[model samples]
Target: DQQVKQNSPSLSVQEGRISILNCDYTNSMFDYFLWYKKYPAEGPTFLISISSIKDKNEDGRFTVFLNKSAKHLSLHIVPSQPGDSAVYFCARETSGSRLTFGEGTQLTVNP
Candidate 1:
């Protein structure tokens, strides 16, 4: 069974608008959540993260929110720009040095 899921396959937004990506997980033991942005052929880069202790964490234009009780999380990007277009993946770090990742949501920012 897949522990992590990104319900939306893709998202489109105009430049300067906001983009919201949703993710859900089934594993209750997950204490750390992370969002990664990947380009066409490059590796995924870490974007933002949130620990189970906090409800939200923000970094520049990226914000990650986690709901431990519901096993859900979301990434928000405000004033999205063209360069921000990428495939965003939600990941969970397990205690066994393994990271579980969602399918990923492709974001398109129109200029």
Candidate 2:
């Protein structure tokens, strides 16, 4: 019962380009959407979050877009840098604060 899925296992982008990570979910009851970035040997760090009521949220070079009807969401990193390379996970939070995460997508930003 994998409610969330990341269709692409990895993504590679040249530095200074845009990096787009996509995710899809089967559960419509989700209340919040979040993206986390994890580096090797490090715990996942909260990158950005979006409420179900909003379609898009932006913070600095990162932006998250949610499409309720499509059950899809995407995280966009503009002017991607080498340091942005990491395993990115997309998660959905249910009513009780339980979160379901998709298989992470490893993003590599090459200089």
Each model's lDDT comes to 0.91, 0.93
Candidate 1 C-alpha lDDT tens digits along 1-111: 538999999999999999999999995776788899999999999998888899999999999988778888999999899999999999988878578899999999999
Candidate 1, lDDT over the whole model = 0.91
- Index of the highest-TM-score prediction: 2
Using Cα atoms with residue i matched to residue i, what is each candidate's TM-score against the true structure? 0.95, 0.95
Tens-digit per-residue lDDT, 1-111, candidate 2: 538899999999999999999999985776788899999999999999999899999999999999889989999999999999999999888757877888999999999
Clashes of 1: 0
Error of 2 at 21 (Å): 0.2
Cα-based lDDT at residue 40, candidate 1: 97
Q: Which segments of candidate 1 are over 4 A away from where they belong? A: none
Q: After superposition, which runs of candidate 2 have C-alpha atoms over 4 Å from their true positions? A: none
